[model samples]
Target: MKKTGEKTWQLRLYVAGQTAKSITALANLKKICETHLAGQYEIEVIDLVQNPKLAAGDQILAIPTLVRRLPSPIKKIIGDLSNETRVLVGLDLRQG
Candidate 1:
């Protein structure tokens, strides 16, 4: 159970495997969360290669997808996530 008004970001990263792009996305996501959300966020990595059924839950159509499942109104960003500015905007951490 979550406390009301207490922000805890629930993030899900959908990846095929430990590919370079998937690894990069995870690294970038961690860096951003550490810089912004810090302890206020939880990340769940889902390897579609191992569990392909999980992708349907999030409707994942691409590799290295970042899904923001908490804080209402789910959002997704697909890529290696190397572009910091774009990632920040995509995650709604900053206004575009």
Candidate 2:
């Protein structure tokens, strides 16, 4: 359960399957969240391979897409998330 007043960073990662790109994206996401958002975040991984319909909701055009669903003004970053700086900037964690 979540506290009424606490804010949590909600992230959704869209991937097709357990491909190398998907695995890498997930790993990088974990590390980034731990280093930045810490315990104040939640990750919801959506495997399109399991449920292709879920992709439409997020308008996912590619695999390994990370969507920031919280903190308003939803944001998106597409790729394997190999670049920490790019991820951070895309997520609004740092200046572009």
Candidate 3:
């Protein structure tokens, strides 16, 4: 349950270097955050090429994966994030 002033959305995007998919994913994620979550969200982008060891921590199996770490139950979406509806659903902003 979200308490008073504690409903921030925490997101992490894991990618391998700056591939085309990774770049698109970041752009899409930023748009979603700005349009949907806005000030109530935070995004962290991690490049696996620079730090491969970090992937194990989040169990990232894909090159471009979006992980939602906050707002209670965690969720993940794997892909370039071109599908806006799917992204919204993954973030729990819409019915999945």
Candidate 4:
């Protein structure tokens, strides 16, 4: 259903608010997407505070969770997103 040239790869970052961990996750996700996916990625940030119901939708068990919702296979990463290698692997941006 995604249009051509629009990223089939979809991502969502779940955070509580403007906390340090949340900020770091956002920044790190941006950097990775820019570096690897470039213009072929769509990132949607969801604030659990605003939409607490969505938490159950993704079955989120913790804060600062990154969900890759598209590109055929889904993936997830937890924590502050400070670990680049782990994120890359989780998002399938890099090989193990």
Candidate 5:
């Protein structure tokens, strides 16, 4: 139930500090948001190394898990986000 022109998408990227995989995920997400979502998205990066407890909240069993918290039909994408098509589809950013 988001307002018009007001996106309520809440995204959280769980990573283990600034590793190569984490850096890639961050860069890929930033690029996607800028190119597609633009000003209609909120991305929060969580460092698991700093807070392991948060992992349980999301039921995360893998490193670099991206969780779409807000908005209905929550989704998740694991790994370094190397597959653009998969990431976009998982996040509902692109039509099938």
Candidate 6:
């Protein structure tokens, strides 16, 4: 996660395909970023179905996994990301 005038977020959303969970995760991520990071974030959706080779680089063993590759430390979250609160917490953001 990032705050105003802070580092840009290099996020990678790893998904298998156009599955419902994948779509939901992407949508949820977009909403979260818009509400929080806004212009300070960049999401790179990687469809494993198209390029499975990329999975190894991120050690992605699960579908719908989000990887925050920017800032000081990198963080990863796996799932549909429907829980807005949990997602925020995982990204190290404030509850408010």
Tell me, by TM-score, which candidate is best.
Answer: 2
Minimum summed lDDT over a 10-residue window in model 2 is located at 1-10
- Highest lDDT against the true fold, candidate: 2
Better candidate number, 1 or 6, judged by TM-score: 1
Off by over 4 Å in 5: 1-7
> What's the residue-level lDDT of 51 in candidate 4?
88
lDDT of 1 by residue, 44-63 (tens): 89999999889898899999
* TM-score of candidate 6 on Cα atoms, chains taken together: 0.88
Per-residue lDDT of 17-89 in model 4, one digit per residue for the tens?
7899999889998998898887788999999999899999988988899999987577889999898899998
Q: List per-prediction Cα lDDT, in the order shown.
A: 0.91, 0.92, 0.90, 0.89, 0.88, 0.89
How do these models rank on lDDT, best leading? 2, 1, 3, 6, 4, 5
List ranges where model 3 is wrong by over 4 Å.
Answer: 1-7
- TM-score against truth, every candidate: 0.91, 0.92, 0.90, 0.92, 0.89, 0.88
Model 3 TM-score (2 dp): 0.90
Tens-digit lDDT track of model 2 for 34-78: 999987998999999999988888899988999999877899999
Q: Which ten residues in a row have the lowest lDDT in candidate 3?
A: 1-10
Question: Model 5 over residues 1-96: C-alpha lDDT tens digits?
Answer: 677865687899999988999999999988888887888899999999999899899898888899998776778899998888888988887875
- Total colliding residue pairs, candidate 3: 0
Candidate 3 vs 4: which has more TM-score: 4
The alpha-carbon lDDT assigned to residue 25 of candidate 4 equals 88
Model 2 regions more than 4 Å off: 1-7
Clashing pairs in 4: none
After the best TM-score superposition of candidate 2, give how far the Cα of residue 74 lies from its true spot, in angstroms.
Answer: 0.8
| Candidate 1 Cα misplacement greater than 4 A, ranges | 4-7
